[model samples]
Target: MKVLSGIHEPTKGTITINNINYNKLDHKLAAQLGIGIIYQELSVIDELTVLENLYIGRHLTKKICGVNIIDWREMRVRAAMMLLRVGLKVDLDEKVANLSISHKQMLEIAKTLMLDAKVIIMDEPTSSLTNKEVDYLLSSISDHESVA
Candidate 1:
């Protein structure tokens, strides 16, 4: 999965996506190519608000007085939509540390969706989820697959 996500390079074989062969790749390129990964370990920042976490490295920005500033309104709107898609309903300003484990997992899925990822590789996504959460997560994935 690390190799596929461009965290590590393959020693031999090449990776082909959308008919393009990549001999070398990096995390940024992989994300731009719609490849997203959710590791077994939760990656969401506990101190950050839901909206902040959603747009951490890729915040929407607008030029104001010749300076770039985060477009908070746009980020909130998009983050809400992404959260809805993953069946996660929470305040955008709420901190992640206040969320449940299942909610955090759902937040991870929402993050990937916000990236417009076409292919999501989840590593033991259900490991920490309860039976009901697992069912919900599976249903969400199936729905996303059909739509994509």
Candidate 2:
């Protein structure tokens, strides 16, 4: 799985997605090929708002006079759409720390979905969830697959 995520390289092998050979897929190539991975450990930053977390790694920034400026309005619009797709309704500006564990998990899925990830690799998705949370996650995945 780490190999797929570009975190590790295979010693001797070939990875072909849809028959296209990615000799040694790095993070950029993996993302372009719509591959995303979600580990069991919660990765949402507690100090940031839901919106901030969504755009944390790859902010919608544009270069302007040698300065990188984040496009806040565009990000908020897209974040709202992603939340809707995930069946979540958290305030975009609300701190992640204030959300329940289930909600935080949902946020992570939303991020993956936003990447337009055709193939998602989840590691122990329900490791620390309540039975109820587990049910919610499973149901959400079912719905997503159906639509996909």
TM-score of each: 0.86, 0.77
Cα miss at 103, model 2 (Å)? 2.4
Instruction: For residues 97-145, write the lDDT of model 1, one tens digit per residue.
Output: 9999888988987887777677888888778778877787678778554
Error of 2 at 32 (Å): 1.1
Best by lDDT: 1
Distance from true position, residue 60, model 1, in Å? Answer: 1.2
Q: Per-residue lDDT of 1-148 in model 2, one digit per residue for the tens?
A: 8798888998887998988877688888888888888877788999999998998778897788999999888899999988876667799999999999878988887888778677888887667567876676677666554222
As for candidate 2, its clashing pairs are: none
Instruction: Name the lDDT of candidate 2.
Output: 0.82
Provide the clashing-pair count of each candidate structure: 0, 0
Say which candidate scores most in TM-score.
1
lDDT of 1: 0.83
